[model samples]
Target: MGNFLCSSSVGRKLIMSLSGCFLVLFLIFHMSMNIAAIFSEDAYNMICAFLGANWYALVATVILAGGVIVHLVYAVLLTLQNRKARGAQRYAVTVKEEGVAWSSKNMLLIGFIVVLGLLLHLYNFWYHMQLQELLGNHTNDFGYSPADGVSLIRDLFAQPVFCVIYLVWFAAIWFHLTHGVWSMFQSVGFANATWYPRLKLISNIMATIIFLGFAVVVVVFYIKSICPACCVA
Candidate 1:
């Protein structure tokens, strides 16, 4: 069974699907954390401090990183394997297939964008706060307390360029999730003739919800930065 999972195509996909699902769950949690910032910076920072450099949080972070690595590695392997299997036929098919979403066809490209965005996010947030804390720093490079997530968010999104870049990143994630969510279930044999459409709809809804949840926080913070006095009241 272990060899089958490690060596077979179906096994590789199953591993990828499971890891993707795990990451999606983490996204929901992270999105919820961002949403909390919109309501109360104190509350958000409390959450961040609770999760920063703590044993459990470190363990969770390691697990999350593992999931990300596994998912990306398998995605690349499967894409290459599929292309090899298709050979010249891959280029020969010029017409669009019914029910094949554009995201499904261009997932690898979108995945790269998603990864680049993820790296930017980690550098901006994780490196500043948790990594600093782990390194025994009391404050980040910006001089804000490592746990001061609200200030970080305010500073990062206050810039117009960052706001635009993050919005674009969110769109890339939406594209990835539109196909990925349902595909996760499909890999586990949960998708079929009766359930495919339903799963697709669910995936779209989930993607949109996550996109809006994170985007709203960025937009709101940018607005607040523009009119601090108005926001205070």
Candidate 2:
């Protein structure tokens, strides 16, 4: 079983599908947490405190990191394998293929953008908060407590440049998810004549929901930063 999984094409895709699904669930949970900050900073901070540098959170973080690594590795391997199989034919295609989503064609490019965004996010939040906590520092370099997610959000989003960058990142993630979600199901043997369109629709809806969920937090915080009186009143 292990050899098959490591050596077979179908088995490799199965791995990607499983890891992709795991990451999608994490995205949903993260979006929910970000939404909480919009409603109540106190509640959001409390939640962050519970999760910050704790044993369970750390364990989950390690596992989530593993999933991300596995997903990325498999995606790259699959792309290379496909390109090798196609040979020069890959470049010979001049006309756009019918029924194929543009996102489906450019997933690797979009995924690269998503990864860049993830690195920025890690440096901004995780490095500041959880890493500080692990290093025995109560407060981050920004002069706020490590778990003070609300303040961090406010400080970062207050800069219009970061706001634009994050929004663009979210859009890239949206593009990645649209094809990824459908591919996840397809890899698991769900593709068929009747279910193709349905799966595409489902993937689009899930991607849009996640996109809106994360985008709303950034948009709301940016607005509050510029118009403090507007949010308070």
Candidate 3:
């Protein structure tokens, strides 16, 4: 079992699927919270306070970080192993492209782009919010306090450049998830002939929902920033 997990393609893909599914759940929770920020600042801040550097939340954060690290490491390892197995024939052409799409062929590149976006997101929000709270500095730029997540989000999205960058990052994430969600299931033996199309459709719907949920918050907040008079009485 140990050797299989360490050295086998199927085992690595299984790990990737499990970790990817875990992250998807996390994204759903996060997007829901972000959507709250759009309706009520106090409610959003309250949610943030609940998740504030408390023991359980911190532990969950650590576990989530570990999952991301493990998934990324295994992805790189598997890609390298596959490349080595293919040797000089890595670029050989194949007429049998019926089962493969562009994304399946470029998962690594999409994964890298997704990782880069995640790093930027972590720096913009996590470092300032949770990490600061953990270190006991609970006040941010607006003086609203560390877990004042609504304020932090509003401030960040108010900047035009940052808003544009975040939009781009979210776009990359959407593309990554569109392929990843179903592919994970396919890896775990759930994508037989009858199930493949259904799973792909479900994946697209899930990806679209997540992307729009996140995008709406960013775009709405940005618009609010630009036209505060329009939102206020």
RMSD of each: 1.4, 1.4, 2.1
Looking at model 1, the pairs that clash are none
Model 3 residue 229 CA deviation (Å) reads 3.4
Give the per-residue lDDT digits (tens) of candidate 1, residues 85-192: 878655644888896899999988999999999999999999999999999999999999999999899999999999999999999999999999999999889979
lDDT of 3 by residue, 44-130 (tens): 989988988999999999999998998899889888888888787555666647767677677789888889989988888787788
User: Model 2, 79-108: lDDT tens per residue?
Assistant: 999998979655544877888788989988
List runs of model 3 lying over 4 Å from the truth.
Answer: 89-99
RMSD over all Cα atoms, model 3: 2.1
| Candidate 1: stretches off by over 4 Å | 88-93, 230-233
**By TM-score, how accurate is candidate 3?**
0.92
Q: Residue 138 error for model 3, in Å?
A: 3.2
- Where model 2 places Cα greater than 4 Å from the true spot, the runs are 88-93
